[model samples]
Target chain A: MMEEGVKKFLYVNRKAPYGTIYALEALEVVLIGAAFDQDVSLAFLDDGVFQLTRDQNTDGVGVKNFSPTFRALGDYDVNKLYVERESLEERGLTADDLQEIVYEDEDDDWAEKPSIRIISRAEMADLMHDQDVILSF
Target chain B: MSTLHTVNKSPFATQSLLSCINHVKDGDAILLIEDGVYGAAAGTGVSDAVAGKAGSVKFYVLGPDLEARGIPATRLLEGVEVVDYAGFVGLAVEHDRAQAWL
Candidate 1:
């Protein structure tokens, strides 16, 4: 299951949802890029973790809540979502507060598994360093 | 006259929270809204600064914003109160004036 010329693409999201168009626009770009079949990963740090928080109702603001779209990412084979532990701690958040995103492992008898991975800030830096392309928002 | 100061930016990202803290007078209340709730967490680089002002100024964070950001009330610094939307309105009404730190 090896492919030649496959580049690692990492999308770094650091903005809060609904406050600005950055989070939403970054999400759209990730979805569109999924069609290219690149080795994609998403890194959420700073205020970006707020984008994946549960129970986001935008009815009062009249903006469509696009958080549900993240669940669909697994369908596009973009399931690697790495959240920085230090960022969450600084914001007083835990992994349990985030919306559950699961993907089926084709290699492991189609077993369902979580898509979100909580990683340290240093580990996040290592991840960024290993990427072939990094797109920051 | 007492004042209610509202800060909407994150402490790590901008100077809005710190500036608001520096300028708050005794008996004034500082309300952390939106991304500003990050400043309410315990053991941060700015925790001592916040605690240093605790004796003079009251600190509060919007409950909904904290919940939206997944920040539990238990994770907040000692003495930082969590206020609901109604409480937010109450603070605005209770204070003689309202100041928004942009």
Candidate 2:
């Protein structure tokens, strides 16, 4: 259970994965923050939306291909992942092109439901304002 | 409330430090970590930019980062504070938010 004084933490990912370490590092922070039971939400905008694209094959590049770790986020109780609609449209991607993430809600008798929420740019801006801490990468 | 801004890239490597300086508001605090500690060095070209904000904005450099990079505390620009990880967390609590310039 979350503590009474939990602060809203919004991790803004605006960069692409692989070329830079921002994407992976941001994920590490998210996982750590969840362990502290902080109210955490991740926002994917601009090139960051690329981090979630489906069918990422790193065999050619010889990288770890850590994208699959996102699937495990639900178990950490860090399920609020928001992807910006404008970012996806600009990148020529649709929601279906990304990996499907789901979490089991214990409060609802452990029912499974989709975890990724596709939000508009305006909604993202509003969400940004609502955060007590904004970690941008 | 002020915001605690953290920059972890070198100014020579990228414009992350410069961009961060540009976005700082009055009463805000800037903490340099990792390669960003390079900007606090006395002779770096970006020192003038940091020096310019002396009165309005507080400046800080992570001590462990500076030591790891072999940058002595005496070599930092005037008015820059050296902080450890504990101080970093304290600054976060002191400020309204923390913005990491990646």
Candidate 3:
């Protein structure tokens, strides 16, 4: 059960990784906020979905590959990642293009479940509407 | 509920403006600020897409941003309106939420 002071915080990610510092910075913010025990969710739309793509090799770009950090989110109780379907389709990408991110459901005998949920654009707007605080990066 | 969508990038340089347009609802408003002011200009490649949504969606451009870019108010599309910093705040207050399309 959520605590009385637990606010619903949504982190909206829209930029592509590597080209700028936004994607990595957003990830760091989410990790730090996870410690607060707030009701946290992440929305990845537009180029933001590129951050979840698998097999990211940053050696050529001389940048650290932080994509693996996403898999560790479940350990922090930071799950419920919403990826927009229309954004992916527009970029010619599919769910298969993304890395597998999952979380363990404590109520269901700690059963493992997928963390990334692919939702439509309309659904994404509704998700935004339901948030108590929306932070975009 | 309505949302105030802010686009701060040039339409020719990025897909932020178009992507925002795709996700906006009928009652929502779109505000062009910074480089986003370019999207308010008329006869551009994406003007039709912006104009088509005019009846249900309200569009506004930041006056200072347009002045900085040397784009006069008359250059804006037929339905696009000009808003100052105070008007920007007003739009934010008027809407249920403000989403910046960065």
**DockQ for all models:** 0.02, 0.25, 0.50
Error of 1 at A106 (Å): 1.1
Judge the docking of candidate 1 as incorrect, acceptable, medium or high.
Answer: incorrect
User: For every model in order, what is the number of clashing pairs?
Assistant: 0, 0, 0
Worst 10 residues of 1 chain B by lDDT: B15-24
Deviation in angstroms for B46 in model 1? Answer: 13
* Candidate 2 per-residue C-alpha lDDT over B1-102 given as tens digits, one digit per residue, 9 for 90 to 100: 678889999999876777567656778899999999999988778989989987899999999999998988889899999999999999989988778878
Higher-DockQ candidate of 1 and 2: 2
TM-score for chain A in each prediction: 0.97, 0.96, 0.97
Ordering by TM-score: 3, 2, 1
Q: Give, for candidate 3 chain A, the lowest lDDT window spanning 10 residues.
A: A125-134
- For model 2 the interface RMSD, in Å, equals 4.8
lDDT of each: 0.86, 0.87, 0.92
- Candidate 1: list runs displaced more than 4 Å: B1-102
lDDT of 3 by residue, B1-102 (tens): 778889999999998888888878878899999999999999999999899888889999999999999998788999999999999999999997778888
Which candidate leads in lDDT? 3
- Per-residue lDDT for A75 in model 2? 98
Model 1 RMSD vs true structure: 15.7
